[model samples]
Target: MRQALVVRGGWDGHQPVEATDLFLPFLKDHDFEVRVTDSPSVYADPAVMGGVDLILQCMTMSTITAEEVAGLVAAVEAGTGLAGWHGGICDAYRASADYLQLVGGQFAAHASRYAPGERSGEQADNYVPHRIEITAGDHEITRGIADFELETEQYWVLTDDYNEVLATTTTATRSWGAWQRPVTCPAVWTRQWGAGRVFVATPGHRVEVLQDLNVRTIVERGLLWAAR
Candidate 1:
């Protein structure tokens, strides 16, 4: 059986645990023996990481030690699949440039309204409904998916040209930043790191966002496609 690892824990606002829980059963249903952890120490274990076939990380905005980062990069390069959604994967380990480069993109800014108790200013009032376009319809990750609408944070990610974009969202009328014209940003993408496959989706700011049928389907397919 394939071994999968789920490491979750970061900003409570992202509900990493709850978000990961939603997909745990799905992974199991796919015949994977899933292991769960709340610590990054597991990444430092070469033996443990060497055995993992897939890694679903939900650690948002956290710091990772050099040892942990080294182990993770090595594992992925050796062919372990890496997949995650929202800030959990892409927005994590901001201090580590190596981690960002591996993931293909970073959470530069979120165009969403600030929640209660969050700093309420003009800068935080950009949440609005948006549509995700299925760009690479022939790709396995988005093969049968269609364009879908959602009311969630439209991530303004800073991405690299290495990504194979599967889906995208437009930022033409966003009120948060200074960009006046519409810019198409990647919503879903896949890339290769050494021998491993990396998959990412920029949605899922909340559990409900993941619960959306189309979002769930895309994510599920992305995970399975990325797995070795």
Candidate 2:
């Protein structure tokens, strides 16, 4: 069986442990030998990560040691798939530009308003209901998934050219704030690194939200699509 390593723990607000747990059985059922660890030791030893097929990161908004970051980059470059949600991969390792570049996007600001007709960050509500627009219909990751609605935070991310966008969400203008800009956010996206694949979803802030069928399907498909 192919191995999948999960290093989960960072900001408690993202519920890293709980969120990572949601995918353990799913991966195991798919024949991946899943190993869950707290320390980033696997990232340090290339030998440990060498034969691994996938890495699922639940760490959010945390700093990573240079060696840890390097090990992950090396592993992915060696063709191990990397995948995560929310801020785990994107907002993590704030000081490491290398990490952000490897992930293909960075979480800039949360509540700040963006410019008009530009892709800018917006204030998103967790309880707000919104629709996820399927942008790339032919992608395997979103093959069966259609436009869906859910109650989650609409992610306003600054994307890089590497992302093969599969879906997006329309940014609504808020009169409560003084921003006069219309922005569209990427809700789900996939990117390639070396021979490996990376997939990200921005809606999974709360554990309960991941229980939604649409959300679960998107993430579920992402896991399989991202795996080597």
Candidate 3:
């Protein structure tokens, strides 16, 4: 049986526990013996990380110790799969450049809904409809998945060229923001870090977002694909 470590906890606004809970059964059903924790300290334990095949994390905008970050990167470099979505993985550990490099992207901001003549600059104001375009048809994680749309937080992620971008979303020109040109960002991507694989999706801001047929499909497949 494969082993998976689920590390969750951070900004409660992201509902780390609730979000990670959505996939526990799926992991168990797939023959993975899963362990759950609300801390990143486990990554510092070589013995624990060495035995794990995958790490499914959901902690957003939290800090990880230098030791923890190093261990986590080493584990992935040694072939442990790393996977998560939205602010969980990408928006975390902003102080750690190494972790950002491992994930291949950083969460910048979400464009506000910009409804003309309405209150803006808040969470509800930022929740808007966006399209996720699958750019790589041949990739195993995205194969057969068509483009989909959702009314949620569309992440404006800063990504590097090293990522194998399987999906992308284009941002719209907003009247409230200074930027006039529409921006295109990677919504889903995979990175090969040494012997391990890393998968990420920017769509999962809420439980319902994760439950989206296409979003769930790709995320589940991404979890399975990232296992060592």
Model 1 TM-score, all chains together: 0.93
Tell me which residue pairs clash in candidate 2.
none
Better of 1 and 3 by TM-score: 3
- lDDT per residue for candidate 1 within 1-228, as digits (tens), equals 899999999998788999999999999999999999998889999989999999999998898999999899999999999999999999999999989999999988765554444656643255558899998999987888889998878887989999999999987644545668877889999999999999999998879899999999988987898888
lDDT of 3 by residue, 1-228 (tens): 999999999998888998899999999999999999999999999999999999999999899999999999999999999999999999988999999999999999887787556856567787888899999989999999988889999999999999999999999988777788999999999999999999999999988889999999999999999999
In order, the Cα lDDT scores of the candidates are: 0.89, 0.80, 0.94
Least lDDT summed over 10 consecutive residues: which range in candidate 2?
118-127
Q: Which is superior by TM-score, 1 or 2?
A: 1
Ranking by lDDT: 3, 1, 2
Model 2, residue 205: distance off in Å is 0.8
Q: List, residue by residue over 36-130, the lDDT tens digit for candidate 2.
A: 98776679887798988988988887778899889988888878888888887777777987788788877654432433454333333334567
Question: Cα lDDT for residue 130, model 2?
Answer: 72
Could you tell which candidate, 1 or 2, scores higher by lDDT?
1
Point out where model 3 deviates above 4 Å: 115-117, 120-122
Q: Which 10 successive residues of model 3 have the least lDDT summed?
A: 114-123
Best by TM-score: 3
